[model samples]
Target: MQILDTYLTKAIANNDTRIPWGSLKYLIGEVMYGGQAIDNFDRRVLRTYMNEYMGDFIFDTFQPFYFHHSPDVSYYIPTTQVDAQQQGLPMKEMCLGISR
Candidate 1:
């Protein structure tokens, strides 16, 4: 977030805050998913998901952000941020799968 904030600050100073979508996508995918990606196929899938989620069109009001669009499991991006406390899920519930 600090790096992103610095990037935003620099862009603002230059009076051009338009984000470079391609670079943003690559950097985010590399940072967030690169280590977890086990193989070429995994990397390709990660890139594809990043391409879908990270784009300028995300800011368009008419564009619908769907993480997954299917008959069985449909998920969309939340319009507003919710506090962790407000979510009412306990820490164990939230991080259910992995034992720490």
Candidate 2:
């Protein structure tokens, strides 16, 4: 979990948009399915931080693939930020995986 936290922080700091969303979804699913667990506070904090970090994109873009267990969430990019030259948007494509 610490590794996940560190990687998440670095990804956010570097504006890495290539996150492996499938992996993250798997981790969250595991936590939800009783395959793994985290302290409630940790889960809440991570969710809140991620929600804030990604803004509305979390729901508008990522949520669909997230619900489907797919790693591709870049398709939902906001029109204003869709230009290929964008920096942060690229990093947003990368989803973080949870390490066992």
Candidate 3:
């Protein structure tokens, strides 16, 4: 999540929410996970995952993050997971949702 940290840092420094999403998307999809993908399908999956999980919508604190959602249950990050130790405050564990 270093990329996210860097983006947050810059956002704070500039007092702007407008991230260079095009470049960030490419960096996440190609530079980060692309090399680990075994094949074209694998690469596509990585790209899709990045598109869904990484976006400007994340800046909206009013909205809750839903990694997975259904009528029965929804997975979300807990507010208590915020880590102050990082350069840009990041959750210690984003997938810690056990219920609700």
Candidate 4:
């Protein structure tokens, strides 16, 4: 979680806006589960979170991919695939329409 906190701090410090909420949700989910497939989700979330939280502080527009982290040591495996699978879809869709 330290890595996530650090990234959030950087985004706050840079005053960058334009992060996507959808992507942010995905990122937080990924982080909590420890998945690396969509690790970029973290950068997307911070960018969006900063933008939403500190819009006026932004100096210039920046792309999401520009914020990169070292791949070698940062890669992580999520505890489960359930989180990624459930993202963006309703519980019904995620569960294939099985009655809850």
Estimate the TM-score of every prediction: 0.56, 0.26, 0.52, 0.27
lDDT of 3 by residue, 1-100 (tens): 6975786688789988677777788877887767888999988877777787788776568997767677865555556644532334334444433232
lDDT sort, best first? 3, 1, 2, 4
Instruction: Rank by TM-score, highest first.
Output: 1, 3, 4, 2
Q: Which candidate achieves the best lDDT against the true structure? A: 3
Residue 65 displacement in candidate 4 (angstroms): 31
Off by over 4 Å in 4: 18-20, 34-100
Give the winner by lDDT: 2 or 3.
3
For each candidate, C-alpha RMSD in Å?
5.1, 13.1, 6.8, 16.1
Which one wins on TM-score? 1
lDDT tens digits, residue span 14-93, model 1: 99867787766666677655888899998997888777778876667787766456785545555666454336334552
Q: How many backbone clashes does candidate 2 have?
A: 14
RMSD (CA, Å), candidate 2 to true, equals: 13.1
Error of 2 at 45 (Å): 23
Candidates in order have lDDT scores of 0.66, 0.51, 0.68, 0.46
- State candidate 3's TM-score: 0.52
